[model samples]
Target chain A: MSHRSFVWLCLLPLAAVTVAFFLLPMARLVVTGAEGPQGLAGYLAILTEPRYRATLLNTVLLATATTIVTLIVATVAGMFLQRHRFPGRAILIAMLTFPLAFPGVVVGFMIILLAGRQGLIGDFSNRVLGEKLVFAYSIYGLFLGYLYFSIPRVILTIMAAVQKLDTGLEEAARSLGASPWAVQRDVVLPALAPAFVASGAIAFATAMGAFGTAFTLATNIDVLPMLIYTEFTLAANFSVSAALSVGLGIITWLILALARSFSGSAVAAAG
Target chain B: MSAQAGHGASVRIEACGKTFADGTRALEPATLEIARGETLVLLGPSGCGKTTMLRIIAGLELPDAGGRVLFDGKDMTAVPIERRNVGMVFQSYALFPNMSVSDNIGYGLKIRGVPEKERAARVAELVALTNISGLENRRIDQLSGGQRQRVALARAVAIRPGILLLDEPLTALDAALRDRLRGELNRLLRALGITTIYVTHDQSEAMELGDRVVVMQKGKIAQIGTPREIYFTPNSRFVAEFIGAANIVEAAIENGHLVLPGGRQPIDGDANISAAVAMIRPETIRVLAAESAPLSGVIDSVSFIGDRQRLVVSGVSNRSLTVDAPNTVRAKSGERIGLSISPDAVRLLPPER
Candidate 1:
C-alpha cells in the first residue's frame, strides 16, 4: 500500500501495547483512587492525613539527600578513576559497578551485614567505645541502602562525561595563568554539570520508588513505598494506597521533568 | 598598541630533551636560542619532536635531567606553566565553551586580578585587533571555525605575555582559510613583536612567518637556518626533500661532472669523489630544445597546475625527474624534451643513509 499506511501499520503493535499496559492501567489507578468511602477526598488525605503526610515528607527528604550525596561521591570517584591508569584498574571499575547487578533486597542485606546489630560496625564499636552501635533498622539504614543502590549508575554516567573532556582545555587554562583549583572551578566543573543533573534525576526517582530495600530493613521505616504496601495488603485500604501510588508517580515524574529542563539549559550554556 | 609591543624576553633552551614515561624518546637533547622579539618556527613532519620541543619551552613538559630552560637568563625550569607568563594557542583552540567571546579573551586578565573596567577595555582592544568585533557576547560553539581561531588568538594575546607558543594553530582549518589566516597571523605577530615559537609541518607557513626555521626529523634536529638558507643550501637530502620538492640524483662524478643516463651535468664540487648525491629543485630545471641542451629526457607525464605545469621526465637520471615549467609551455606525455640547469643551482649533499 502507501508508505504512510505501511509506517502506521508497523506502529500498530506499539500503540496496542501502550493502551493495554500503560494508559489503561494509569486510568484505572486514578479511578480506583476516588472509589473509597472518603470519595474524592481520599486523594486529599494523602496530604491532609497526618500519618500519610509524614511518610511522604520522609520519602522526599531521603531521596533528596540520597541524590545529593551520590552525585558528590560519584563525581569525585569517577574523575579519579577516569584520569589515572594502574594495575587492576579494569577490575576495580567492574567491582565499583557490581552493585548495579544486585536487587534492592540484596543491597539492604549488605547494609545490615555492615551496620546492623551483631554486624561488623556494632562489634567494632562495642569493643572500642564500650557501646554497641546499631542503626540498621532506622531511617539511616534505608538511606545507606539507597546510596548503595544509586551510586553505581551515577558513577558510570560521570565517568563517561569525564572521558569526553578535552585535556587541551585544562592546559590552555593553565597557560593563561589559571591555577589548578581555578581550572577545575571554571572549566572542568561547568563542563560536567549536565551529567550531574541527568544522573542525579535517575538516582532521585529510584530512591523515591524503592520498596524491597525498606521492606528488608524494617516495617516502621515510613517510606512512601512501604506505606503503600502496608495500606494495600495489611490494612486492605486499597483506595488510599492507589491514591498514594498515583501521588508518588506524579511527584517523581514532575521532579524528573524539572531536572530535564535544568539540564537542557546547562547543555546550552556549556556549548 | 606599540606600548604593548617589545615586551618579549629572549629564551634559551640548553640541551633540552624529553623521554616519555613509557620509554619512548620524543626528543633528543638539543640546544637553541630565540632572540627577543623574534619568531622561530619548528618545522617537521609528525612525530619529529617539534611539538615536544615546543612543550619543553612552554613549560608543559619537563626536559630530562641536566637540561635547563631560561628566559632572559633566569632559570625557569622549576616554574609551572601558570606562572610562566606564556600564551599558547592549541591546535583545537581550546576556547572555553561556557564563556562568551569577551569572557574568554579576558580570562587571563581576570586570573591576574585585573579590575573589571580594565579587563573589559583590554578585551575590547583584542576584539578589534583580531577583527572579531560584534561577537563579544556570542558563545564559542556559536562561531565558525575561522571565528573560533580568531577568538583563540585574541585570548592568547590579551594577557600581553612575554612569549607566545603556537602548536599547529591553523592546522585544523580548510586550506583556503588556512592560507588567509596564515597571512593575517604573520602580520599580527609582526605587530606584536613577541618572542614567538611556532610548530607546524607546513613549509609555506614556516617560510612566510619564521625569522629562522628549525627542521627536525626522527626526534632530532636535522637543520636550522633562515628559510632561504634552508631552501637553497640544505646540508642533507632529507632537509632538501622535506623543505620542498627536490630531484635527488645518485650519480658517479668524473672530472667535476655528474654522469647521468641522459647526459653529463657539470658541478662545482671536487671531482675526486667516485659517486655523490645532488639535489635539484623542480623549478630550477629549465625545459629547452632537445637538440640544443646537453641533458635530455622523454616526458612520462604532464600535470597542468595553475601557475606551473609539472612534467615527470624519465631517462634523465637514475629515476624520473620532476620539472615545474611555466603553464604557457606546450608539452605532453611521450614527448622528447631538453633540460638545462645552472651548475651553481645543483647542491651537493652528503651521501644517503
Candidate 2:
C-alpha cells in the first residue's frame, strides 16, 4: 500500500470510534427526546413547570456566579504564576491544575470533608456560632464543589495565554505616561480579553452541566443535574429524563457557540 | 516641522553606568554629550552596552552609580520616561496592531491631552511628511515593512519631542529598502533638526546616518568622533579593527624611523612610540608587479568582488596582508607580487593590551 493510503487506513478505527461513541449517542438522544411519547409537549413541560423551571434558572445563575468568581481567582493566580518568581511556584501551579486529574466524585467528597456539616469549617461554624452551617448541602455548596474543577481549567488556559502575551505592550504603555493601573486597564486587560472570554465560557458550561459533584452534594438542594438523575433512575420516567437531558445539552451547546464566537473574534483582532 | 523647534535640547551624561541585579555590568561609567540638533549614533557590536546607553537616556533604565543625565542644562536624573518629553522608535516598530496608522501616530499627542482637532491635523501633517498620507486608515498588519517604519517614525515625532531615540530602526528592512529609507531619514531628520540618538551595530549605517559616532566596547565607550575621524584616524586598535577591514602591522620606531618585518618599508607617522601597530586601510594598499616591486610577496589567493578584487598576500616572514585592487588587476596563485601603502594613510595605535 502507498504511504498516504496506509495513513488513512490507520485513522479509520479512531474516526469510527468517535462517531459510534459520541455522535451516535447524541444523535440518538436527540431523536428519542423528540419522538418518544408526548414528544415536544414533554420538553415544553420541563421548561414550563416551576420546579423544573427553577432548576434551569438556578443552573444558569449558579454557573454565572461560578464563572465570575472562578475567573477572578484564576486570572489573579494565572498572572501571578506567569510573572512573579517566588519559591514553590512550580508546586503551586501543579496544585492548581491537579484537580483536573481527579474524578468529580473524589473532588465532591473532598469538598464535603472540608465544608460539610460535620466537616472542618462546618464543625467550626456550628460550635463557634451555635448554628449548623449547610455549606456542603446548599446551592453555594454546589458552586464550591464545581469550583474545584472549574477554577483549575480556567487557570491553566489563562496562564498559557498570559505566558504567550507580548510583554512589550505593557512596557510600551508604561513608557507612554501610563501608571500601573492605566497600563493594566488599557494594555494588559485588552490583551487578555479574548482568553478571559474563552475561559469564562468553558467555566460556565462546566458548572452548568456538572453531574457527579451536584449529585454527591444534593442533600438540602435539588439542582438541574440531580433532578435529571432522579427522573431517570428514581421516577422511572425516560421521557422526562431525556427531555431534561436535551435541555441541558442545548444550554451547553449555546455556551460552546458563544466560546467559539469569542475565540474567533479574538483571533481576528490579534491578526 | 520647523527645524528651529528641535534645537536647544542638548543632553549631557556624566559618569553613567549600569550593573544589573545579576551582577552583569551592562554599561560602565561613561560620560558624553549630545549637542543641540546633533545626530549621534551609538555604534557597537552586540552586548557592548550601546543599547543600554540609549535606554538610560530614554529613562527606561537607571544608572547604578556616578551618573547624572541632564537635558538642556537641567538635571533630569530622577525624571521618568514619560515625563522626559523624549520620543523613541523601537527596533520592531511596535506599532499598535489594532490601531489605524492615524491613531498610532496620534497616540502620544492624545496621551498628552492635545485637543482632538489639533491631534487630527498633526497626524495628517505627519502622515504627509512620511509620504504615507494615503495609508492613514490602514492597520499596521496591512502595511509593508517600509510603510510600518514610516508610521513608527511619524508616531515618534508626532509629539514634537525635544529628543528622538531610534533603536536599529532600519535593521528589519531589506538592503534596497534600508538604503532608500536611510536617505529619506537623513533628509527628514535634518529638516526637523530633532536631537536624535540612533543606535546600530552596522558600521556603514553609523557612518551614513550619524553626524558623530560613539563606538562602545564591553560596557564602555571605545571612541567618539566623526565618521571620517573614526574611519581615517581611529583612536584605538579596537576602533580601527571594528570600523572596517584594516591591515594592522606591528612595527617599531628605531632611530626615528619605522621598521617592519619581511624587508617592508616604513610608513611615516608620529615616531614617539618605541613599538606600535600601523593601521592601514585596505584601499590604501597598492599592488605592483614583482619586477618593479619594493617589497615582494606571493599572491596566496584572489577574490573578485564586483568593483574591486581582494588579494591575500603572504610575505617571506609568513605575515599575511589583504590588499584591494581594481577588478582589472588580475594575478595568478603563487605569483610573486609587491605591496606598498601610502605613508600618509598609516595611523599608529598603541600596542595591544
Candidate 3:
C-alpha cells in the first residue's frame, strides 16, 4: 500500500472507536434533548430552576477553588522537585504521583477514611477541638476529594516543564546583579508561566468533570455532576442529564480556550 | 581612562583553592595579581581550572582552602556575587531570552537602580560601542552568533563594572568572525580601560590580546609572564611544549659545548645541569645541502604551507625534527637533507621534574 493509505489504515480504528462510543452517543444525547416531546423545554427548565442554578454555581466555585489551591501547591512542589536534589527526591516525586495510578473512586474512599466525620483526623479534630469535622457530603468534601487526584497531575506536568527550562537564564539574571528573589520573580516565574497555565487548565477541567469522587462524597450539597447523575438515574430524565453534561463541556472548553490564549504569549516569551 | 590609571582597583588573589564534595579538585591553591586596566588572559588546555578560577574571582564558586581576593585593596572574600559588581560574559552567551537586546544590555543598570533615562542613554552608548545599534529590538533567539556575542559584550560593559570576566567568549564563533571580533574587542577594551580577565584554550588569542599570559596546567599556574617571555624563554619543559610547538631534543653539556646524538653545538646559557632538552622552533631550523650540513636526515614528508613549506626529517638516530623553509626550496620525500640551527635559537628548558 501507499504511505498515505497505510497511515489512513492505522488511524481507522481510532476513528471508528471515537465515532462509535463518543460522537454517536453525544449526538444522540443532543438530538434527544432538542427533538424530544418536550423539545428543549427540559433544558430550559434546568437552566431556569434555582436549585439547578445553585448547583451549577457551586460546581464552578468548587472547581475554581480546587484549581487555585492545586496550582499553588503543585507549582511550589514542582519547583522543589526540579531544583533541589536530595536523597529522597525520587521517592518524593513518586509519592506525589501515586494518586494518578489509583482510580478516582478508590481515592475518594481513601480520602473518606482519612477525613470523614468518623475517620482518623476527623475524629481527632472532633475530640480535641470540640468541633465536628464533616467532609463527606459537602462541596468542601467534594473539593478535598478532587484535590487528592488533581494536585498530582498538576505537579507532574509542571515538574516536566520546569525541568525542561534552561537554567542559564537564572544564572544570567543573577550575574546581572539581580537579587535571588528578583531572579525568581523576573526570570524563573516568567519562564514557568506557560506550564503553570497549562497545568491549571488541566486541573480545573479534571475537577469540573469529576463524577466518581463527587458521587461518592455527595450529601446535602449537589454539584452539577451529581445533579446530572440524579436526573438520569433517579428521576429518569436523560434529556436533562444530557443538557447538564453539554453545559459542563462548554464551560470546560471555554476555560481551556482561555488557558491556551494566556499560555501562547508565555511560550512566545520563553522562546 | 585617567581615573582608572590613577585610582582603579587592582585584583589580588592569594592561596585560593576549590574542592568539590566529590573530592574532585577543580582548583589548587593559586596566587596571582591583576593590575588595574590590564587585560590578563588565562590560557590552558581543557580541564586546567581556568574556568574555575574565573568563577572564584566572580564569586560564583568559593574556594575550600585559604585565599583572599582583594579588590582595590579591600577584602572581598565574603562578598556575594551580586554585591561584587563583577560583570561576566559566559561561554554560552547567557542572554536573557525574555528581554530584547537593548533590555538585556540595560538589565544590570536596572538592577543597580539607575534611572530610566540614564539607563537608556548608557544602553545606547554601549550598543553603539559594540556596533550593534541596529539590533536593539532583536531578541536573543533571533540573533546570529556574532550578533549575540556583540550583545553579550555590550551588556557586560554597560554596567561599567570594576572588572570584566570573559569565559571563552569568542570560542563559539566561526574562525573568520572570531578573527574579526578579536581586533574589534581589543580596540573596544582599550578604549574602555576596564580591568578584564579573558580565559581561553587558544594560545594565539592569549598572545594577541593579553598584556600578560598565565599558562595553567593540572590546577596550578605553570608560568605567568609577557607573551614574548612565555613563548621564547619558557621556564620549564611543560611551559615550552604547552605554549608552542617546540622540538625537544635531549642534549648533554660537555667541554663547554652541547652534544646531541646527531651533532655538537656551543651552549649559550650557563649549563649547571648535565642534561637538558634543547627547545628548537621550526623557523629556527635551516635546511642545508648535504656537503655543508651539520646534521643529515632523510626527508620523510614535505608539504606547502601558506607562507612557507614544512619538512619532516627523520635523523639516522630515528629522531624526527620539523623544519620550516621558504616555499622556493624544493625538496622531495626520501631525499637526504642537512639541518642547521644557530646556538642562539636553541633554548635549554629545565628537565621535566
Candidate 4:
C-alpha cells in the first residue's frame, strides 16, 4: 500500500472504537431523548420543570464553588510546598495526593466519618454546644467530597507550574523595587494563569459529572447526577434522564470553553 | 540627565562572605570599594563566586553576620534589594513575558506609584534611549534576543537607581551580538554614569567595560586592578592566565636575567632569587632571525589569524611558547626563529602556592 493508505490503516482501529463506543451511544442517547410524549420538548423539560431546574442549578453552583475554592487553596499550598524545603515535606505532599487514588464513594465516606451524625465533628459539637451538628447526608457532604479529590489534582498541576517558574523573574521584580507582595501580584500570579485554567477546568468537570459520592451520601440530595440516576432507574423515565445527561455534558463543556476563552485573553493581555 | 549626574552612589562592601545552608562556602570574606560613577567588573569562571558576590552586593543574598554593605558611607547591610533601590539585569534577561516592552520597562516606576502619565513618559523615554522605540506596544516574546537585552537594560535603569548590578547581561546572546552589545552597553553606562558592578567571565568584556576588574578564583579574589595593571603586572599565575593569553616560563634567575633553555632572558626583579615564575604576553614576544636574538626556537606550527599570525614555537622552554607574529611576515612551520622580548615586558610572579 502507499504511504497515505498505510496512515489510514493505522487510524482504522481508533475509528472503529470511537464509532462503536462513543458516537453510536451518543446518537442513540439524543434520539432516545426525544422519543417521549413531549417529543422534542423533552430536552426543554430539564429547564422548564421546577424540580429538574433546581437540581441543575444546585449542581452548577456546587461545582462552581468547589472549583473556585479548590483553586484558591491549591494555589497557596502548592506555591508554598514547591518553594520551601523542610522535614516531612515529602510525606506531606504524598498524603495530600493520596486522595487521587480514592474513588468518589470513599471520599464521601471519609467526609461522613468526619461530619456524619455519629462522627467526630458531631460528637465534638454535641459536647460543646448542646446540639448535634450533622451535615454528612446533605449537599455539603458531597461538596466536601468533591473538594477532597479536586484539590489534589489542582495542587499537582500548580506545583508543576510553580517548579517551572523562572526565579529570575521574581528577583528582577525585587531589584526593580517591587515588594514581595507586589512581586507575587505582578509576576508570579500572572505567569501561572495558564495552569490555573487547565487544572480548574478539570476540577469543574469532575465535580459536575461525579455520581458515586452523591449516591452514597443520601438519595434526597438534589444534584443532577443523582436526579438522573433516580429518574432512569426508579421512575423508568429514560427519555428525561437521557435529555438531562446531554444537558449536563453540554453545560459542563460550555462553561469550560468559556473559562478557557476568558483566560486566553487574560494570558495574551499579560504577554 | 543632569539629575542623574553625581547621583551615583559609591559602594563599599566590607568583608562580605556567604556560606550556604548546606555548608558550602560560596564566597570568601572579601572587601572592595567602588568609586562613584565607576564600573567595576567581577570576572571569573563559572562557580567562582562572582555571582555570589554580586548577589551579596545586590542584597539578594545576605552576607554572614558582621559582613556589611554600605552605600556612600551609609550602612545598608540589613536593607533588602527592594528597599536598597539597586537596579539589576540578569543573564537570562528575565523580561516579564506577560507584559509589553513598555510595561516591562516601566514596571519599577509603577511599583513606586509614579503616576500613569509620568510612567508613560518615562517608558517612552527609555524606549527611545534603548533604541527600541517602535517595540513599545509589542510583547516581550515578540522581540529578538538583542531587543530583549535592550529592554532588560532599560527596565533596570528606568527607576533612576543609585547603583546598577548586572550578572553576565550579554552572556546569553550569540558571540557577534554579544560584542556589538558590549560596545553599546559601554556607551550606555558612560552616558548614565551610575555606580555599576558588572559580572562576566569574558576577559575581553571585563577589559573593555570595567574601570577596575576583580579577577576571582575558587571563591576568592585573585587580583583587583585596572585592565592594564592586571594584564601587565598580574600578581599571580592564576590572574595572568585567567585575564588573557600568557606563556608561563619557569626559569632560574642570574644577575636579574631569567635563565631559560633557549637563552638568558632579562627580567626586572631581585638578582639573588634562585628561581622564578615569569609571565610573558604573547604579543610582547617578537620573532626574528635565529642568529640575531638571544632566545631561539623552532616553529612547530603557524596559524594565520586575520590581524596577526600565531606560531607555536618549540625548544624555547620545557613547554611550547605561543608567539604572535605580524600578519605581513611570512613564516612557515619547521622554521628556526629567534624571539626578542624586552626586559620590562617580562613580569616575575611569585611562585605558586
Best by DockQ: 4
Give the Å shift of residue A188 in candidate 2. 2.5
Count of backbone clashes, every candidate in sequence: 0, 0, 0, 1
lDDT of 4 by residue, A1-271 (tens): 9999999999999999999999999999999999989999999999999999999999999999999999999999999999999999999999999999988888888989999989899999999998998999999988888999999999998999999999999999999999999999999999999999888888999999999888888999999999999999999999999999999989988888787896773321100
TM-score of chain B of each: 0.97, 0.94, 0.95, 0.97
Q: Decide which is better by lDDT, 1 or 4.
A: 1
- Model 4 lDDT on a 0 to 1 scale: 0.92
Provide TM-scores for the models: 0.94, 0.89, 0.92, 0.96
lDDT of 4 at B194: 90
Chain A TM per prediction: 0.95, 0.88, 0.88, 0.95
Q: In model 1 chain B, where is the ten-residue run with the lowest total lDDT?
A: B1-10
- After aligning candidate 2 to the native by TM-score, how far in Å is the CA of A225 from where it should be? 1.7
Write the residue-wise lDDT of candidate 1 on A96-123 in tens digits. 8998888888988998999999789999
* Stretches > 4 Å off in candidate 4: A262-271, B1-6
Give the share of true interchain contacts found in each model.
Answer: 0.86, 0.22, 0.60, 0.90
Give the per-residue Cα lDDT of candidate 1 at B59. 93
Report the error of model 4 at residue A267, Å: 16
Off by over 4 Å in 1: A1-6, A265-271, B1-6, B269-272, B328-335
User: Model 1: what TM-score?
Assistant: 0.94
Candidate 2 structure quality by residue, lDDT tens digits, B1-353: 22344563899999999999889999989999998888999999999999999999988899877799999999988998878888788888877766788988988887888999999999999999999978989988899999999998998888888888999999999999999999999899888888999999999989988989999999889999999999999978899989989887776667544565545565675576787677888898788877675567888999989899898888722368888998888787799887776777778776656
Q: Per lDDT, what order, best first?
A: 1, 4, 3, 2
Residues B1-353 of candidate 1: C-alpha lDDT, one tens digit per residue: 12234558889999998999999999999999988888999999999999999999999999999899999999999899999999999999999999999999999999999999999999999999999999999999999999999999999999999899999999999999999999999999998899999999999999999999999999999999999999999999889999989999999989999999999999985767989899999999999989999899999999999999999999999999999999999998999999999999899997666
Best by lDDT: 1
